[model samples]
Target: MRSLVLVGHGSHLNGDSAGAVYYYAELVRQQGIFAEVIEGYWKEEPSLRQVLKTSASTEVTVIPMFISEGYFTETVIPRELGLGHQGPVPEGGIARVIGGRTVRYTLPYGVHPKMQDVILARAREVLPDLDRPEVGRDTTLVVLGHGTTRNENSNKVIERNAAALRERGIFAEVHALYLDEDPKVGTWPERVGAKNVVIVPFFASEGWHTQETIPAELGLTGTATLFTDTPSGPQTVYYTKPVGTHPMIAEVILQLAAEASQARGGDLDRTHAESWRLLTRLAHGGLRVGEVLISPYSGLLELRHMLDEGRPTTDLLTYVTPEGLRDRVRQDDAGEYRPVRTFRTLPRGWRAVVDEADLRRALHYIYPAVVEETRAYTCHSLRATPWPTTARRQTGIYAKVQKASSAQVEAVAQKVCAACLRTRLWAAEPLGQTFFDGVPGGIPCAEACTYLVAAVRDELSAEKSPEKQDQAKLEQA
Candidate 1:
């Protein structure tokens, strides 16, 4: 079976860092090119170490969703994937045989030749006039990157991109600026020597750096193009969104994965046929996902939306495909979007009948990463992160959650997690066994999800509010 793994440097404090990775994973999955497509992270749930399941696929292609080849792409991913304590990685990436499986590691998409096109595409969006040679001749393009002292090559990747841009001759002057290293983002005025300047972040996603740091340093306003008075003269600066936001980047990542897959004798069509038996065999035992009961029926899996005991399936909606099932789960009864899939808000009255081959894939669409989560739980490889441990890592909006009392944690979990179908094995301390004891083969939650964190943060915020303090004062009076 041909399997593709998209790996990213996920941030615990901020969820937006790995946003692009998830976006592309879903995009690739919908294309139906690979039998299995999943995501791995360095700091978030479904981490790199635990993401790789013992699936039927002997060949797995891992593509780094990083802009540059740095400490993470080089040292971190290889170690976690058991690709050996390595030397230097090739530009195209390397293929290694580990424990009866072949792992193909591709270079990060940022350094690919196609990145020049992505950067230019983003630039064109900011400055439409750049298509004209005169505008290009007058413009200065700034490729902003986050440089690090730990790895000199992190900044070097951005520098090489700048050099390539200069050779392309679209922009009169192209400069590479870093947040950490020399030729920093703060020195844009002195560093750049053009009246028309365009700054584009070379990093992935609009995270803390792109949203908070870069704007503050560059003195950017709400408008896309702004004028600033400098020592040289009045300058017009056009700020484009980061390269990671560009949709064209999807093409680059897919091409890299395809090259590695095809080179290693991967058959996309037959991979599905080979993996169907093994993957479906895992789901042979009945399990409940959300309010749905999945059981084997006549060589096919039947997913029925659960009703009250002694109730019939008379009013339920019937679906024959995974897409229909996913659509049903994406919204509530009121038609509002439910980002958390396993919540009690799963729209009821829907049934789906799919073959063994489509069962795992269909379940994945309705409940993201449940197949791997179940496998991890089954093998006892699941690392259940405690709620407090996860709360402590949040140094942003959810930081106050770390100070929550035991009772507060329990109240929040009962309100939020009790409504979720996923068994909170990680939250067993505050919420006892009786909380999720009745759930049937419940989805195993490894860590505190983003929704739970938001809920805890809200409760904590309300606890310390001045309104609550005033109410306490009135009671005392």
Candidate 2:
């Protein structure tokens, strides 16, 4: 059997990075397409060297889940794997191929042609009816992704996809956005110049960039579909989920793995079989903790699986940083040099000590009744007008609601007004006492106070749309 290895730019702090890798790998396995599939991460446990060793087979293929093919894929990965680029290695050389298996590496996931399918799928999902003759001609589509400051290729990927979609006549207009660099996300509304804007993330998965940064910047307050009241008083703003987890992504992974294996002179079909077994083993956490902490994203999943399998609770510290979180030990076994960003993890831990008290004190300013009132005002803003599609689409009433939504665009305003309030409460529940430290008036509290209000609003709107429609019909009749 051949083998395929899926490599990701993993994060020690965030579980989502690894989660994306595992999600795609599992998708490949479920199709019964590969003989063996294994995953190795840069930050988490089971270093690349270790995974490459354990996954040794006659022919091995490595697929990088990175969005761009510049630095990491071209330089770092090859340097680490000892696959020399300058020339064919003599018998004894620094860059040597081992495992008696031909090694092949494929293109990064973002560069895949099939990615266009996801962009289309997201547009269709958000604007299913928008494509009708009446809606299709008037709508403007924004294929937004997190462009990078470090890499030019990242922005190109989004731009290429948007251009391809426009060439196909899918949307009246299409544009790209970035978290950093020029033509930033903040300026997208003006650039598109359309009446309705649908923002679709060109990201691999839903993490901070997709979940927090993008929405916060756009002033989005609902689900994947962000809408505002129109000047005539109708709803507008559609935000789609990150394109990574869609069912179609599994096919892309398999296709890339096969391509990589073929480049190394291996049987693509057999390579998959080898990959399956390896992936299953990795899922079982076969590798030990070693000296470093694995990714909190996949490592957390693996840890949970290990716990389920009766593995001892090793002295693990899940590191939290702005970059992401990690399931780690104190020793620097990871051989990683990037600095970790700080974040909160569990009950009364580092985040609790640092931000919990402050958070609780803030919650008092956000008592349940106060939060509920804020939701009322914000929800009113949502239903108050038709969403503006572009900079020109802004009208008197729509502008009024947009301004109102922007004003209350905080945890308190959003939670009270949208459905995510419940989840926001749960996510923030751990820090309750900390926030209540010096509060008076009998420890005032509420059920929802911490999630991005706009996201929760969208979730609630989607869930209740059908019911809402029926109510509207009844009133009209």
Candidate 3:
């Protein structure tokens, strides 16, 4: 058993980009694929450097969760991971000895054949639901990938998988579409020439491309719909989850490591023999498996034994709490404990109160998105149950605004909502068009940044005040 690091080129603009990898990592950890499974991003917290450093396993494997073997995998990741050149560990970047540990890197996840199986499995999930008996043999499956002019191979991988599916005679036809170049998504309806189409994204993860660009370009106002406009009679469209997240993905990762180890004259059966037990543990939710390795090297089990005593870093926030003041005490009363005060703010002219218990409950129930009648934003989705609505905002994890100006409270509510939105909680729904439609008050990125900046400004202003000046100086000293 060794350590596994799945790295992604995350996006600041689309929170789902990171969400995809994190969810997958959590699943992998739950399955116990490795003793230590970490999800690192280029844009978010726990950067590639930090993830690698924090991993306690002596033998480690790096898996590029990217959908392409282009710039990021060929150059950026190799240079960053110190995995050397396109061939071995010497041509790309620095190779330093860290904590007496040895690390190996593998190819991008998309290149693995097992991933092809994942694509097919995901396609099957949506195809059956969207397939029309009336459409019959005319139905087509469009396998969409975030094709790039910079990397023709990206589209090629998707196209190859489409061809494979077509060979199976599962669909009347299958085709590949790109986001960057021609054969675009808008042209899909024309190419398919079928009354029904099931579109499966070959992306490694979900993000803006899947949630925003793909939907708008394909004239899909909603997911899984039937359209009769494209000269193909009635067309039913269905979009499936990205290929990287399918349950079969873990098996693909194992296949890669097994094959790589065998190519080096290592016994594939011997290598996989130990992996079978690990895989079983993973299947049974083995998050605490001692010393797991997710790489392609020959010495995985030894590495696992070496890492036996090390504590896992996956419990980073097991006992974490939300930041900020939960209550404002202009006129404190001991009886307030019956419900307890919650933090709230007004969006327009509306003001509300949220009880403390209700606020705590909302942190769990209103996940991914929370609809509070007016505005909504992304938040770092918290896990808590939803409480009943008593004082408007008091029902959820947020109480109504009290003792503070409406502007001040609105700002706080917006921030809380934004955090929820980012965490995929908005109005008790994930704040994406694919999952939730008609977001009354859309949460734009600029507004989120403004709210964050304003919050910091207010905190600094309060700290600079005479009341807190002495306290701030003392802390600084």
Compare the candidates by lDDT and give the number of the best one.
1
Better of 1 and 2 by lDDT: 1
Cα deviation in Å at residue 89, candidate 1? 1.7
Off by over 4 Å in 2: 86-96, 224-235, 263-477
- In order, candidate lDDTs are 0.73, 0.50, 0.49
Candidate 1 lDDT over residue span 19-43, tens digit each? 6887888788878877777777776
lDDT of 1: 0.73
RMSD of candidate 1 to the truth, in angstroms, is: 7.0
Q: Over the full model, what C-alpha lDDT does candidate 3 score relative to the true structure?
A: 0.49
Winning candidate number (TM-score): 1
Tell me how far the alpha carbon of residue 137 in candidate 1 is from the true structure, in angstroms, after superposition: 1.6
Candidate 3 RMSD to the real structure? 19.5
Worst 10 residues of 1 by lDDT: 429-438
- The superposed Cα distance between candidate 2 and the true structure at residue 283, in angstroms, equals 19
In order of appearance, the predictions have TM-scores of 0.67, 0.53, 0.51
Clash count for candidate 3 is 50
